[model samples]
Target: MNVDELILVSIDDHVVEPADMFKNHLPANLADQAPHVETDASGVDRWIYQGRVTGVSGLNAVVTWPPEEWAKDPAGFAEMRPAVYDIHDRVRDMDRNGILASMCFPTFAGFSAGHLNHFKDPLTVIMIQAYNDWHIDEWAGTYPGRFIPLALLPTWDPQLMVAEIRRVAAKGCRAVTMPELPHLEGLPSYHDITYWGPVFAALSETGLVMCLHIGTGFGALKLAPDAPIDNLIILA
Candidate 1:
């Protein structure tokens, strides 16, 4: 069959979270603590949460750039494609590439958001829910069936994880990203069935799928700490 006849639906696409993601989603009291984008002296935009920088604005959103250009990080959101975060532009880009639909994973705080566990704050659960709301209410909801809603769970607690599963499922999210290796994120490993039993049951009850995205729990591949970022991207 000709390439033009192909109907592709990408199950592993990603979105570079917008600067004002938490603006409408979070409660007023928590608004001050919500993650926001900040530009460093170098001009690279990074997501800052609770006074700490989480992830860069354009970590892997350089798909359309030339190979030689991929080695360099996007100076800021202005340098990245609007499709990387804008729902309408994303659909247009999909059409240009002959993609029917896409299930996008998180990139703002990372795939599973396990980094939030480092904070040990009760507000982490609220943040996860707010992110899911933005993903379901704004991102995928804007385009209806053109985009698939995937959520990030509060993996630090099994009870919270189950609650988030049911909550996002109620918002029309079909899948939630799970840390591929939960133990690495300070959670009980998959081998500990007792700890994860409720989480599994919640997914089964909500009819939501669990997506184990690689590198969410760990790096794509182990390499020296001094390895170049471009090498990690290419090899992974």
Candidate 2:
């Protein structure tokens, strides 16, 4: 194929977050400990039901698409249809589009780290662990070179944060994204915290790239009443 005929890849696209049933595939004991594994007000039990993460509080509930449909076409109706957190389908879609490779981000995982009021340190650590494992084992593992998994770290806990980074890197993840907002109490930005120095050094050493995507937890911006929303949009 000519250069123009070659497909281009879009790294940094999103896959849906796990639903309440995400733990269903886990061992009974371990799955029981998974958060948000309950029924919703409508009494649905499945994880991807109605595109919401039931049994959990916070913003980790948005659904992208179902796994079956996603397996059929990933980029086609991502905006119009629901999506599953399946990485295999994502790779298939890339292949169908003639894309060579792509990087994937967690849709609901990033939202959890972004919302300050909903996610506490312990919960953040747990969810991050579950999400990372799912990404590496379920997503990247199946696709190998075709997919690059972006690790989600708990910015709230420095020690666990660094350890998680190391663990994911050992599993072949080379990029991680933390919310631009401070997910923990008392710390300013991730750059301002002294404890994060070790984490940063480790990342630099391992050639891991730390990405900051804007989210809700970054703290509130004080906008003057006279300022136009356009300015805020532009800054964003």
Candidate 3:
């Protein structure tokens, strides 16, 4: 056999979160305040709600889109035929490409979290927990050994961070992604956050890697008023 026949593995693939997540998980009172937007024939619901916070009002509105919209659809838009968002399609692609295993990160859910700064801390934490559970139950459990899940910790609270780490680990996650920059004001960088030492140590002991993925770092930057797309490309 050729050595080149060895299987490959991708450590950082992403899956689009299903759109109904917020509709299903948000408290009934809050969910009522959000309006559902139309999705494709998938019957998936997208919702939006304005943020009450200042300085970020434009960025404060949250939008949810169906995961299928992120997938390849031959009958749909020509530009949307990549099929990366569907787990089954992704697995087939991986098999054809000689990939034996893959780890999936959240796409839409994490993107939503970026705009949810105005939400109360408890609600934010609840959202993270719900997303983590949904990923495990709906994604990883579906494929067993073929798909490894990555958890997202509540970076705003160190104690909860440690608890969530253990909880998700027990649910079969092998890695976790935390904000590369502090998510909360007054919190230090990852390297300097003393309260997070135990969390990091626990991850080390468990052989789980703490991933600092893009769009997850903390810092200020300057960008042209009309150059958001170019800025994103350059940053990516």
Candidate 1's C-alpha lDDT?
0.80
Off by over 4 Å in 1: 71-75, 217-221, 224-236
The 10-residue segment of model 2 with minimum total lDDT is: 69-78
Candidate 2 residue pairs in clash (backbone atoms < 3 Å): 36-55, 64-82, 64-83, 65-82, 65-83, 65-84, 181-218
List the pairs of residues colliding in candidate 3: 72-83, 181-218
Question: Residue-wise lDDT of candidate 1 within 2-90, one digit each (tens)?
Answer: 97889899998989888988899987988988878888898778787788776564556877777666643444788888999888899
What's every prediction's RMSD, in angstroms?
Answer: 2.2, 7.3, 7.3
Write candidate 2's Cα lDDT for 86-164 as tens digits: 4555566667668887766565344334432145556446656667777777766677777677887776667777888
Q: What's the residue-level lDDT of 226 in candidate 2?
A: 65
What TM-score would every model get versus the actual structure? 0.91, 0.66, 0.67
Q: In terms of lDDT, which candidate is strongest?
A: 1
- Candidate with best TM-score: 1
Model 2: runs farther than 4 Å from truth? 1-4, 18-27, 37-84, 115-124, 183-186, 191-193, 216-236
